[model samples]
Target: MQRSKVILNSPKIAIGSRADKYWSENGFLDYSKFIRPNLDLPKSLSYGSNPDLLRTKFGIAEIGFGNWVTNEDRFNYVNGLIISLYDLNKLMNIDYFLGLGLLSVSFGARGAGSALAHYESQTKIINVTRYHRGDESKLARFVATGGMGSFAHEYGHFLDYVGGEYVSPHPQVFALTGGRSVSRSRMPCNDRQRLRVITNDLLEKIIWKVPNKTPSAYYTRLAKFMMANGIESDYLIRRNELFARWFEAWVSLKLRSMNIQNKLLSQAKYSPLIYPTENEVREVDKIFQDFMKEFKSGYFIG
Candidate 1:
């Protein structure tokens, strides 16, 4: 008999609902809740004729979540989201793994979901933060502000991992993607050493100037700015860095036009760093306006 294929469906859990439930009793995002439905409710997810194939193929481990930001169990946090092609092969099933992880880390000043994936051994972490509806200040801001595209884009990474179509979009991603394809090899990323160095250096300055604020807090503001400019996935999206640069300019233009300053507690908007260079800034503004006009006229990302 052909083995049954278990296609993991996209799981949804209410905010704070896992407070005392199963793996979420004490807090720190649990992946079981959202992942369970896709594993158990095969028909709802449309996993094809064989559901059991998921277990055998690719070493599939169906996962879900509850408050993932607190940094609880790294292993469990990661284990809760793997779907194996090897296991699926054994079961003769071809099912897609739907990771309902942080669907919306598009808000918040810090790279929440991105950080989680960065620290994890697994390559398939999905950010489902977009699909959720909530009243939490930052989250709500994220919703109202839009640009969950980062999460959606990150999901593409998860899909790539499960398919074993690994490619290093940057040198840093080489470890995760195995540097197998041209597309992956050409990807960009934060300068690993430089990022830490900058973070530490910047933190020192912030500490001396404003002892009340934390570096993480600063990063949060930066994240917001980056997100608004659509440069949050700077290294992920490709095309000679030109598109990325142009895209960022567009975002900067939007934020400037809206006058939405990035305000992290205790951090001052150093006038020099805050929108200096009218010429450079205007260039970005022009690109953004042109892009929007073109977009509205039925063009890219339209």
Candidate 2:
């Protein structure tokens, strides 16, 4: 079968559809305003500004969802969530679902299974849950303090799916391991081709902007910190840790070429735009100093 043609700019939608019903239920009033009659694909041309992947046929649908409370209902609830989240209008099962929400499968903390992106092939869903349902106050605290970092981290995974590299620690990162729980699923031809075009380009630029340190090397450092602090699952580090450091490192470098840096900073509000704390800014400056030394000594290389 021929792949669906890529739509340049995402179209605005007319009301009255499953999306309307879902948005109305979820109270996503702001996002609801953008749904269109046909699939609103962001144009590939506009993606030229994006250094990473170009815009493709695959659509980005972010929904806030959760799972049932206990083990007995976990599987069923997750399945139901996939069904609820799937775009049913795609005439036949050609569409894929990439869920970015919460999962309360176990009785413990909220973000427990957030480390992995759950895939239910039967439903063509790729579930990526990061945050948990902590106390309202705690949730607010996370947002005010470090939620942006978390968002940017997981969002990077979605970018990876479209075409970006996983950039995370290799085997240590289980999301793409060859284990039963982690494997790549194929999308339809049209979706795959178009999505690849857009994502690959954007990701190329995103990755190019980063320093040459491998994720495993950085995670290894994180492991030492965990052991020093007597932490368990020290193997498990928050995704934002990498983003925070990367953001700082990148900004520090850009700070050198003022005009170029300003142009890039202007777009922060749109993509992974972050406002680091004063301390974060200071720390980034320190890293920048280290980066400069390495560059001068000719020991560090991109």
Candidate 3:
């Protein structure tokens, strides 16, 4: 099987602050280093920007920028973006298709240093303010590990887009979010719509079952902040967001359990933050394992 290629790009932009300067110098390089290894992608996966070589259908371009504009001079805060290759259904074989085929993951200098997922474009964005300006070594671990989780979550969306599903063997596990099955093709339009679809029973289950533990004060504070902002509810009730967040947490735990460097435990001091219980972890692990079996056999080729 041929490997998918990724092209990295950073456009020239004016740096407005010391933080932006830090990112301009080291963010993308460090991000590439941190994210690539943890993906556990098949060795066949590669990265490059050469149009001649990436003309193949399997190529993926990763365009990174510091900022994006909503209108004239109005900057929209974004961390990363993943534009689906299939969105260009008409021109799959053309260069225009290849351009949209790229996943645009950006790191914003502004905004709270948090990971975000966007459904419309199938993108994952992370704000890097904390990682670059704060404690570099410590925050790098947080950003890298947390970013990997976000990447996995967003990639889960990609999988759903490509005809894959995120499922568990037990049907009872899904009693809260409608049923045992959901698909990207059939997801609700937005998080608010999703809230209406989820059962109160499921919501209660999450309130009871999902633990609020974290490894460090930072994670604890972050969790509190997100909950206060209603982000946690969005993760719990929305089917797609729920699956992606689970994937994020499960992948983070797996990386830590494996004891790999700069994996999850790179922030060992903040270990166990925002983590699910051991039993819950095992359940999600099985789901991920099952998905990978199908994914490797069907979609991914070596």
Candidate 4:
């Protein structure tokens, strides 16, 4: 589907009897008792969708509570959510797979003044919320900055499911090993070996070389952090969570670069922003391009 049409089908906010029942029964915050639907649901968000190679469709719904809330707040929250999602779509051309369905966002006590977000594969839902203890303004900023990033991170999980496995290193591995069978005992031995080679090359050529870091410290730190935090192992051994984390970092850096002069980073509540050097962006772009090329070739199914 076209990106414009996809945004047209983006989720809408609702707070009447229907929303109340859905949240309460699902164990979400019980705002049904105190909150009532007061504002008109926004037909279109302020942000514009930028489509890339992937043409999947997704949606976002903002749920709010309390008497102090206004239509403006709802619009701001929804706009922020769309902006984040749009950035991801632009970066990864995420529309390639079945789009994320009904991403829900809200503000409430349940989140405990922090951002909570998750992607459910079974339901195909990405839910995000901002919790505030005292200041609603702070909460707004949180949702706009870190909260949006959190939503992108959750969507990254969906992307991982759709695109991660498809972009295997089997071709690269076979090329490196001169078309030998290598070992099918583990089923993904070639893929694993290829990843190891790429990672080591990235580490030695780009990550380890501090002054010569082609990608910049952001990717280097991310690679090191992933290794230190067990993501590399997960990516290699289990093939899960790594792509989501990478997606998160990629979205964060891209947004940060665009907003370098703004105070967005200073006000972020979680996941400090990282700036990628020009060379870093170039390298990462090449990585993603190669992956997408493989994905287009239908390698995973083969």
Candidate 5:
């Protein structure tokens, strides 16, 4: 049979039936069609048959996702998340899910998995630690799924610094002050392509540019939220963190799987400090929704 053509960079890549069939057949390991230069594929490896073999979804990342998952369910969940994001429209906006260069999963909290998750902008990698190995307690699964949530959050950071433009490390709305056209000449662009088109300003219009002696409405709101909740962490108030938290919330709300949602909700309720408040997510939703409408009006103009 002819291998399915995976248009990995397109935002709509995950949509339509062709991609569906491709993922169902585990067609991503066909590295010949997807491999980047200077990298290698281990010869004669089978998908889903051997647990130790590195699994690489070439269209998603240049490297392989291997030896990271310590157990079956966690491994399956990660695969489900990947296939869901790129093939089922199960979790996030395809562009957002594709923000990271690769999701480098690690098991246990002993070594590289110490941190919950972090995104390296230069490498465009999401290093997520999933400590849930085997049939652990429900609490363990909750924490592990929360680790998965961190994976989504770090991708938010990738979206923030993706363009490598001036005055960055903040949420950027595309097409304001064009320092460089980081965007592609394509419609329904992927995260990488969209970053190029977005403005380099650190959310000048969205959170900054406040009037009457206040510099940012978002800061003010976040401050009050922190105060009201009796949360005294300087980390939560950072601009990039705010946007990522909101992005995670947006992803959580958009998730189609109730099972995943329930797991995440349990973790979130148990440890709510890291995620954003409902109003903050809703506020961003309104702001971004309006921004999208305005952005599309001139999307085709030369």
Candidate 6:
């Protein structure tokens, strides 16, 4: 009856599985592989929980939804939503969501795409289409429908907004825990330059400039794809988008959600670029791990 504990209590699809375990367990999903849709799965990801209630760090904006959908459907969306928020939160080690005080999501927003995030007053709102044709309203489908990176991408934009206006720390935001990531002698990302370093270092070093470099060949690949499709390369290859996408790939690595990686390919507009090849993912894994060892703490991400 309670959906809140599904993540902790169920073995269905553990959202927190590390990369190796998730792939080893075959948590990567493909709809074609699923002929029989289990309607009840979404039920477990439904009501009886609120992700904002789960934060051990600072505060998370309590989500408010538009009144155009059934409670079951709303809960389904939230259930899936929190799984992701929590996944990112584990790695945050800092209060990343401190800037925004409230968040609202819309189910029946007019002329809306599958999902989008924007600001209204001080609160941030994510607009997700309530129902689509043949609606895969189930938890996994609902989250992956827009693309795995969608939530992280939009949230990244929200972070840009929050961080842009936020010149300093919130009173409620406590100091960074676990003490430093060694090589992090640099300032506390005032320009909020955490992922930017990855942009210049990790991605730019290996992926962007290098030609046909597997795993890290994000820039070259995106350039080709954008050029071939006639879509402006700038659409996705922007500074802000880059920062957000780094978070997406980081999520892919952290949660080992192959579903996200596959969805990245499926969701072209979203940067599959950030989704590194396993070898590259493995490489970045070591790079970040080593970097953290040297990082002397601070909210690079938080």
On TM-score, the leading prediction is 6
Least well predicted 10-residue stretch by lDDT in candidate 5: 30-39
lDDT of 2 by residue, 1-302 (tens): 11111211223222355644554466423221111112232342221111111112223232222332232122222222222223221211223322222111111123334343332222223343332455675323222221222222332333233221222212332221112221112211233333333322222222232433332333444556667767775223433233333543444334334322221111232222223333434534544344233322221121
* Residue ranges of candidate 6 with Cα displaced over 4 Å: 1-47, 51-58, 95-123, 135-149, 164-203, 210-216, 257-274, 286-302
Best by lDDT: 6
How are the candidates ranked when ordered by TM-score, highest leading?
Answer: 6, 5, 4, 3, 2, 1
- At residue 251, give the lDDT of candidate 1: 41
- Can you write out model 1's per-residue Cα lDDT over 116-155, one digit (the tens) per residue? 2221225343332322345665333332232222322243
lDDT agreement with native, every candidate: 0.30, 0.28, 0.35, 0.39, 0.40, 0.41
Question: Candidate 4, residues 1-302: lDDT per residue as tens digits?
Answer: 01133323444334345744564466433221111112121333222221221123344332333343333333344344434444444455645232433333343212323335555554445544443345465444443443344555555555444433334334333222112232211222434544333322323333334434354365456556657765633322222333444445555566556542112111233333232344554566555445444443443344
Identify the runs in model 2 with alpha carbons over 4 angstroms from their true place.
Answer: 1-58, 61-64, 67-148, 159-223, 231-302
User: Which portions of model 4 show Cα errors greater than 4 Å?
Assistant: 1-73, 94-115, 136-146, 164-241, 255-283, 293-302
Clash-forming residue pairs, model 4: 54-96, 55-95, 56-95, 113-131, 215-280
Ranking by lDDT: 6, 5, 4, 3, 1, 2
Model 2 residue 222 CA deviation (Å) reads 2.9
TM-score of every prediction relative to native:
0.25, 0.28, 0.42, 0.45, 0.49, 0.54
**Residue 248 CA displacement from its true place in model 3, Å:** 1.9
Measured by TM-score, how close is model 4 to the native structure? 0.45
**lDDT by residue (tens digit), candidate 5, 1-302:** 11112222222222235643564466332211111112222333222222222234322443223244323334344333443333212333333234233433332222343456666555556555444546876445534543544655665565455433322222443323221222212213234433333422233333444433444555556567678888875666555665566566766654423323423212243346455556555555655444333333323221
Over 4 Å off, model 5: 1-58, 62-74, 87-114, 132-146, 165-233, 256-275, 289-302
- Give the CA lDDT, 0 to 100, for residue 7 in model 3: 25
Candidate number that wins on TM-score, 1 or 3: 3
Q: How many clashing pairs does model 1 include?
A: 40
What TM-score does prediction 6 earn? Answer: 0.54
lDDT of 6 by residue, 1-302 (tens): 12233223333323334632553355433232121122122333332234433332224444445554444454445444544453444455344343234444444342243344333324465454443335554545544543333555555555544443432333432111101121212223334443333323543444444433333356667667778778853645554455455545555566544333223212334445445555655556654443332231432424
